[model samples]
Target: MIAAVRPQADPPPEATRAPEAVLPQDVHATEAVRATEAAHAPGAAPATARRRPMVAHDLDGLPVPRAAYPLTRLPRNEPHASLDGARIVVSGGRGMGDLAAFPILYDIAARLGGAVGASLPAVDAGWAPVTRQVGISGKYVSPDIYLAIGISGTPQHLAGIDPHTRIVAINNDEQANIFNVAEAGVVAEWQVLLPALLNALDHPGDA
Candidate 1:
């Protein structure tokens, strides 16, 4: 942190006089003349010293002590999931229609050895937990591959994603904003698309 110092007031000028010319051979005479001049010169009164006023800064009431809050431990249900370390992320959104499709989304992520994430609307609609939210208001993600299902790409949501991550967008709307940033896109309804994807995952050769 940088701090600024206040400028101080200038001091008063000192009293001075020109020296008298003295002969080189008359050193004692020159000393006598200088003594006479010093006796005749008017005496200057000593300047009165100014003392700075004592500044008593009382910080007694300035700070407010924080109150100790009661801590309660919640029951642990499952292992903690984080998006930052996830290599692949399969995310769902409001366009998936309902929370019923989350199981299929989760299954796809599990099969691919990835984490499950959700858009803000999907989390708000109770389709996924708040911890899985991905957006400017949620956790930032930089996974190797990001699969966006039924999610419209909003600037706020995209802001949380790393630009280097390969994006794959699947949406019913062909003209979705997600397509602009996605490396690959598929336009299809999730109801038909999800089951087909699961089937492909089950039987890779048959797909």
Candidate 2:
């Protein structure tokens, strides 16, 4: 015997159509959603509670310093050449031979409106002041022009000089280590060279 078949019913029109996406703003418009958001906000207070203002009292309780000493101004000495940001540095070393040579170095530096610097040995030997010492253990200088007279290019001494500075070396020994790093070099000693330089500065008109 054959069996009888029945027809199936179709889905409703609402089920067949796609639902519209709900925006966050649309959800927030509901009273329940708005209340939940208010509960999570930073430093949020209950709707029934009254808020109290906060005040800072740290400065009000802080102690101020009072001067207990006499008000006598100390006598200020004249300012000397500062090594900081010097455009031109005329530096010397033990090869300067004598303390007398320092005065000439100073004169040359004064003529050139530059500062005077010395190597550690020169400073240690009392040839120059400790303030004028330029080396690894002393002041670091970055001058545009570094007139290195009688200085041997030691690692310690070279460490204090800026790599960008243009070095001009003057020494009696042609094979001196200074020449290795010097942009310009002279085989003459500082004694002979400095005097001529000063003379040239003194008489610019003369060749």
Per-residue CA lDDT of model 2 for 1-207, tens digit only, reads 111111122212321110011111111100000112222122334222221221221212222122121213221243446778788898999998867667777766777778889999999999888999987788888888788888876767876777667676766675565655554455554554465566656655552
lDDT string, candidate 1, 61-154, tens digits:
2211122211132313455346769988989988988777677777667777788899999999998898999887887888887888999877
Q: Number of backbone collisions per candidate, in order?
A: 0, 0
True-structure Cα RMSD, model 2: 37.1
Q: Residue 191 CA error for candidate 2 (Å)? A: 1.3
Runs with alpha carbons beyond 4 Å of true place in candidate 1? 1-81
Q: Give each model's whole-structure lDDT.
A: 0.57, 0.57
Model 2: lowest-lDDT 10 consecutive positions: 24-33
Give Cα distance to truth, residue 79, candidate 1, Å: 5.1
